[model samples]
Target: MNFWNRALIIILSLCFLLPVFAADKPNILILGEDAAGDSVPRSSRVFKRVLDALINQMHDKGFDVYDEAVLTLLENNSSHIRRTDSEIIEVARASKRPPIDVVVIFQIYASTQNLEFNTRINTLLMGRLLNVKTGKHLGNFEIDSGKNFTGPAQCQQECILTIVGDKSRILANDLGAVLAEKLVWMNNGDVSEPSKNNKMVTEYALIFDGFNAKEYMAIEEYLVIFSGYTRHRPIEIRHTRSEIWYQSSIGTAKLDRNLNKMLAELDMQSIINFEGNTFTVKRITFRNKEIKENNEVW
Candidate 1:
């Protein structure tokens, strides 16, 4: 091919590949929670309206939002599945769709006060941002809708509609901005330095079941050199179960892989499970005695 023809081919190939290699914006999923930290039904009118408002705000900020209806569909399709905050993670992990990077859990509280002339409606919106991949708490925000005076005969539902319609944008904007900034920092792996404490650390709960004292000691020795390990304190140590408060900069997923790999290397058959910031290690036994341990490590 001629020089100019070859140059044109190269330029066309670059154009086609650039978009594929571009960095994608993080995917966000918003969920509603109740006072007891349980998942609030999305069917509630208040929850639906507030969720729509938040979704609009996020969209305006150029974020890709996951439809909550997909979660409902997943639940309905699975007979044994019940939707909850923690269960959402497991469901997301099992699905083949794009992974959810951040989850926003929000709660809404509304109340009315009676006055001689009219009733005053007040609403409070509380939200928390969590990083799904690392199970890290990003931040929390609380926003209140200023007093809205309505007729004395105004019902709770009418009051909720009035206040939420008027203040939803404000609430969404405040929380959305914070969430956007935190997402950037998390994506860049930039954890803020501790102001009060001199060290940067995250606390995790570690539990071991069916391991002997000698095995526990060996595990501790390995932990001391684990990646991002700072320190740990033993809460309880027993043959049946043991607990330790571990401090590290790494997430539970990484820690789980590391511990399991160490166990295999030591010829200890075990199963490691993790939920959020807690990890549980259980020793497995086999009668054949010829079973092979997994050689894979992440």
Candidate 2:
């Protein structure tokens, strides 16, 4: 009777702790940058508005989002913005700033054409998400809007400005929805936030080979699905072949073995071998038999 009572107490305690553990929301950083390669402030303004809209959307979806401007000011004591992926990730890794799980890079640009009686303007927004720990690009998205104003030439410029702002907000909301879905997928799966003792975790170097384009894509799909389970980054990738090198926290040999089993279950012929802190993968086939035969004739 005492053992049964103790077991019940442990179960109840875990049930209570689980919710608290899951409530630790992931931090996301949104960085806006110039893309026009000019002094024009249009790109900056559009990006700012889009960032604001994305933040609101993420907040509603229960995410903790930070703006680049605020982060820079707080960490660097300046309001300067970083424009590239490396720069953005560098900021996230700084000890002074709050830990970030994901980084969203956003850029906007516009083009205009003047006509005999009207004007046409097109604006585009491009965004991509990166894992802060692995430096892996999870996904990318783009949205564009075009408008034509056939009016008393004077008001044409005003119309274009209004359209730019409106479309920027719409694009931002759509992008946010897509990002939210990705986060939902991660949260529902084995992917967890970076460990607090990540630095203390041992490091491993891994190699994956024998993958063709089709098989590589298959592996990437699995990575995207199981990305939450491990924080690993590819150090080198051979685009024309089936090989990649990655660095990751140690003790992932079991994870790699599980992946090999999962691939075999999917009928992909691959084998993974692990040593102290290094592993290798070799695939039996480059592609499906039918696809290979069809390609051989070409």
lDDT of 1 by residue, 140-196 (tens): 887777656354654566665665556655666676666656665555643233211
Instruction: Summing lDDT over every window of 10 consecutive residues in candidate 2, give the lowest-scoring window.
Output: 13-22
Question: Could you give candidate 2's per-residue lDDT for residues 1-298 as a string of tens digits?
Answer: 3557756854663454321113445568876654346412423455567778888877667565766655555542224443455666787766223456677777776666777765666677777888777787778787777454233344454676676667778878988778766765666632343343444333455556755444565676665455333333444445324432332343475567667776876686767787865567776764478588546644
User: Could you estimate the TM-score for every candidate?
Assistant: 0.47, 0.49
Q: Which stretches in model 2 have alpha-carbon errors above 4 Å?
A: 1-24, 35-43, 74-82, 95-97, 146-159, 189-298
Candidate 1: minimum summed lDDT over ten consecutive residues — where?
Answer: 289-298
lDDT, model 2, position 272? 77
Largest TM-score belongs to which candidate?
2
